[model samples]
Target: MSHVGVTLGVMAAIPALVEPTMLRWARQTQGYSVLAAARKIGIDEDKLAACEAGYERLTIEQLRKAAKAYRRSLAVFFLDTPPEGIDTLRDFRRVAGSESGEWSPELHTEFRRAQQQRDWLIDLLESEDTPVPTAWSLPSSEVARLSDAQLASRIRSHLEGLAGSSGPTTSDRYAHSSFWVSTLEDSGVLVLHTSGGGVATQEMRAMSLYFDRVPVIVLNGSDAVRARTFSLVHEYVHLLLHADGLCDMVTTTRATNPNTALEARCNAVAAEVLMPAAAVRAATESLRGRPVDEWTYERIASAAVRFGTSAEALLLRLVNLGLASRSLYEQRREDFQRAYVEQERSAATGGDFYRTKARDIGKGYVRRVAGAHRRKVIDSFTAATYLDVKVGQITRLAEAAGFASASGR
Candidate 1:
C-alpha cells in the first residue's frame, strides 16, 4: 500500500483521540508495569508504550481493551487526572502463620468492596428516621491501663447494649458472632466478612479502616467460626483505638504484638473482650478436676464452648496464664488450626452462594440494604451495585432477608 493509503487506514482506526496521560496514570496506580499492562490488554509492549507516550494513537477498541484490563470504566480514561483511590492507611496486622506477602490485589479489591458497603449504608441511614448512632470512644490512657477483666467488662457492656442481647450466655456460636456484627452496625461501625478468595493471602485474617466516625472491619470468613469471633473482637479493639490496618491473629499474646505497648494493648484488649481471662480461669478451674498434665483438648474444648470461644484462642490464653504449658498449647493449637482449616475448606466446596454472600456482606448490612431496596429508599440497580450482585439477584437476596416487597422479590 502507498504511504497515504497506510496513513488513511491508521487514521480511520484511531479516531485521532489520545488519552496518553490518563492511560499512564491508570496503569501506574494499578501497580502494572508497561509489559504487564500490555499483556493484560493483549497488546505488544512497544505498541502500548508508544500509545501512552503519545507517539501513536490507540484505536477505540484498544482503549476499551485497556480500560477493561486496568479494571476502570471507559469514562475513567477520559478523566483529566486519576481519581484519588481508597486504601487502608496503616498495617496493624501481626502475621505469624500466613505465607502470603505484603498486600495483594485480591485484598485491595475487597477493601474497595467494603468501602462501597459503607457508602451505601450511609445512604440508607440518611433515608431512615433512626436515632443519632453512638460511636464508642476509647478509654483514656489511665483507663486503657485497666486490667483485662475490667476492660473486658467495659467492652462487653458496650457491645451487648449495642447488640441488645441479654448477656454472655451463649447457645450458638454463629448466633453469638452474628450479634457482634449487628452490634457493630448499631454503633456506627461497618463490619464486612470476606470469605474464600477474601484476602490476597490467607495470612491476612482480618483488616480494619478507621475513617473518622465510619470505622470498617473486614474479616476473613474462611477462618473458623470461632476464629471469626476473635477476629471481630480484635478489629473492634482496633476501631476503639482508631488504629486501622490488616491483621493476622497468628498469636494473641504480647509476643505477637510487635511493640510492647500499643499493639500489645490492642491484642490484650481484644482477647479480654472475646474471652475474658477471668471467664477462662473459672472454666479451667471448674474442669473435672484434672492436673495440669491431665488437661486435654477434650476438656479445653468443653471450656471453649462454655466461653463462646475457639479451643485454639482459649487454649492460647491458658498458655499465657501459665495454666497450660506452652508445649501443650502449641500441640493443641496445631490440632485445632488444622481441623478448623479442613472444615472451612470442606464448606467452601459447593456452599450456598447467596447465604455465603450474605455472610460476606454481613447479615445486618445485607438486611438493611435489602430493606432499603424494599422501601424504595434505593432502586434495585443501586442495591445490586452496592451488594456486588447482578441486578436480578438483588430480588432473591431481598426475599432471603425477608424484605419481600422489593421489586427484586
Candidate 2:
C-alpha cells in the first residue's frame, strides 16, 4: 500500500486529532518506549514512529487510545503547551544516559527550586525586622536528638493550630496531613505520588519557581496515603532546620527505624507535629481503666480519627508512650496495611491522589500564560510553550478558569 493509502486508512479508523505530542509525553512521563507504546496502543511500528517524528497526523481516536495505554486522560494530554525555552528533550536524554547516582531531572529541578525557595524564605524572614527566629536557631544535632514520635506530634500540632486559625477554606491547602517543616538547613517540601502500581511508589517530586511562592509539598494520589503524610511531616522537620536536598523517607520507612540519628530526629519531629508526647500521655491517662496494653485496632482507629491522624500513626504513638508494646504495634501496623490494601483493591482504581510537581507547576504556569493570552499580554506561541500544552488545550483551560469570559474572548 502507498504511504497516503495507509495514512488514510489509519485516519478513517481513528478520526481524532491525536497528536504525536501525546505519545512523546506518555513516553516522557510514564518511562515507556516507542515500541512499548505502539504495541500497547495496537498501532503499527512505522506509523507510531511517524507519529513521534511529527511526520504523521494523529487522529483523536488514536490519541484517546494512547492516553488509555499511558494511563492518562486525553484532557491531561492536552493540558500543557509544547516544550519550549528549556531543552526538555535534551535534559531527558542527559538523564537517561547519565550515571546511576545522578539525580533525575525532576529531582535536580526540585533541588534548584528548593534552594532558591529556602534562600527566598530566609530573605523574607530577615526582611521582617521583627524578632523572628533565625533558621539557625534550631540546631541540626538537637533536631537529631528528638524521637520520631516526638517530631511527628509537634508537626501535627503546628499544622492543627494553623488549620484551626486559617479556617475551612484553608484546610485543603494546609490541613493536608502531608507537609514538611524543619530548621533552615536542607529544608523543603518533597511531594510524590505513586503511578501504575498498587504498592507505594514514587512518581515524581520537584521544586520549581512555580511552587517557590509557598512552602507547599504536593504528592501523587496513587501513593499510600498514610505513608505520604508521614514523609511530608518528616520533610517539614528538615525544612524547620533549614536543610537542603531530598530524602525518600517513605521508601526507606525512616520513621520506623530509630537507629539512624537523622531518621530518628525526623521521626521525632514528625511525631511531635502529629502527636505530642505530652498530649498523648495526657490522653492515655484520661482513658483510665481502658487497658492500654489491650488497645484494639478499633480503639487505635478511633484515636487516630480524634487526633486527625492515621491508625498506624496512633499505634506508633502508643508504642512510644509505652501504652502498647513494640511487637504489638508492629503487628497492628501490618494488619492495618493489609486491610487498607484490600480495601483499595476492592475499589479497583489506578494512580494516586498526590499531585506531581510537573502537574502542579505546569498548571500554575499555564494559568498565568493563559491569562496573558486572553488579555493580549502575550502571543499564542508564548502561551503554548509556557503552558506546555497545545494552543487548543490552552483555550479550553482559559475558558474553564473564566479568564476568557472576563476578557470577552
Candidate 3:
C-alpha cells in the first residue's frame, strides 16, 4: 500500500494504542512538551496525558494532529515491518521515560530519537571497519553511590597514577577536547546543540534503559563554551552513577536552591573530575603568593594558556581554592567574556565549534549507526533513517571509510 494509506490504516487499527507512543515519540523526536502537544491538538492537558498513557482513545482528528505534531508520516506509525532499527528507537523510548511519564513528552522523545539515530550511525561506521565502539557502556551506577569525598579521593588517586613524570605537565592539558568529547559520545552521552534555548542553560539529563541499551546524556545547544564543557563533565558524573533525569547546572540570578542531593553529588563529582582540589591547591602553591587579588586578565589568560584551560576555568579554580573572592571572580569573568566576545567577533563565526561541530560532522549520530550496522544489528535502510539521511549518504560514509565504492550501483 501507499505510505500514506499504510499510516492511515495503522491509525485506524490502533489509534488509541499509538497515542501514548506517538506522544512519547513526538516529544523525543522533536522536543515537544505535553502542554504544547495538547495546545497543538486542542485537547486539555489531562486528556492529552490520558491519551498518551493509552487510557483514552484518540479521534481521527487526534491521529492527524499527532502525525503532524511529530513530523512523521502516518505510514511511519504503522509499518508492518518494524522500521529496520525500531528496537534501538524503542529502547530509547522506553529508557527515556516513555512508559513512566517522568519526562516532559517533548524532551523525552527528542533525546531518545537522537540517541537511537546516533547509535545507528555508529553501528554503520563500524561495519565499514571503523574502530569506534557502538556505545560507551560504562558502569556509572556502581560509582555514583560513592560520597563526594570518596569520589574526590578516587579521582585524585586515578590522576596520580595517570600523571607520571613524563606526562603532560599542565593540569589543563590532560587531553584534547575532541578526544574527551568523542569519548563521551561513545559512552552513550547524547550531546547536541540546542537550536533554541535560554542562556546559562544546559543539563545532564537522567539515563533511560530503553531497549536495554545503557543510559544516555543530553546536553543543551544554547550554552556558552565553558558552560558546555561543564555540562559534559556533569553528565559524565550522571553516567557514572547510572542515574537519569535532568541536572541543570546553570546558576540563575533568581536565588534558586541548590541541586537535589543526587544532583549536588553529581556536581561535586563533576567539579572533582574536571578540577581536583588537591591539584588546584598544589598548583596554587606553586604560584606561591602570586597576589591573586591583583592578577590582571592578561595574567589569568596567560596562566590558562599555560595550563591549557580557559581563563574562566582558572578563575573558578582560584575561587574554589579560596585564593580569590566571589566579587573578584565575577569581575574576572566579565572581563573574560568581554574579551571572548571581541575575539569571536573578529573571527566572525556563526557559532562556537565545540557547540555545533559534532552535529555538523555527523559525528554524534552517524558514527553510532555505522557501528550498529557493522555489528549486523541493523540493515542499511535502518542506518539511513536513523541518521536522517538517504541510503546513498550511508554509502558515502562507507566509501569515506575506505569501503569499495557503490557509486556505480
C-alpha positional error of residue 36 in candidate 2 after TM-score superposition, expressed in Å:
12
**Which is the leading candidate under TM-score?**
1
Q: Show the colliding residue pairs in model 1.
A: 93-247, 395-408
Model 2: residues >4 Å from true position, as ranges?
Answer: 1-175, 178-220, 245-259, 282-288, 292-294, 343-388, 392-409
Candidate 2: tens digits of C-alpha lDDT, residues 72-177? 6577566445435322211111122231223333443333333333343434344443233322223457556755555454444445454343212121222443
Q: Estimated TM-score per prediction? A: 0.81, 0.48, 0.59
Tens digits of per-residue lDDT for model 3 on 1-409? 9999999777665644453565566545555677887887777888878876778877766767777776566666544333453323211112232222234434544554555555654455555666543244434564657677677556434433433212133434324334345555554444554434422232233233322243455556544444455566666665555554454553222322333555556566666665666666666564536776557766665555433456667776677667777787776777886875564356455744322433433354544555566666788787666655577677555444323332232
lDDT of 1: 0.70
Write down the TM-score for model 1. 0.81
- Clashes (backbone N, CA, C under 3 Å), per candidate, total 2, 74, 57
For candidate 2, what is the TM-score? 0.48
Q: How much is the lDDT of residue 386 in candidate 3? A: 69
RMSD of 2: 11.4
Off by more than 4 A, model 1:
1-25, 28-36, 46-59, 78-81, 94-101, 127-132, 135-149, 195-201, 252-261, 286-288, 343-350, 402-409
The root-mean-square deviation over C-alpha atoms between each candidate and the true structure, in angstroms, is 4.8, 11.4, 8.4
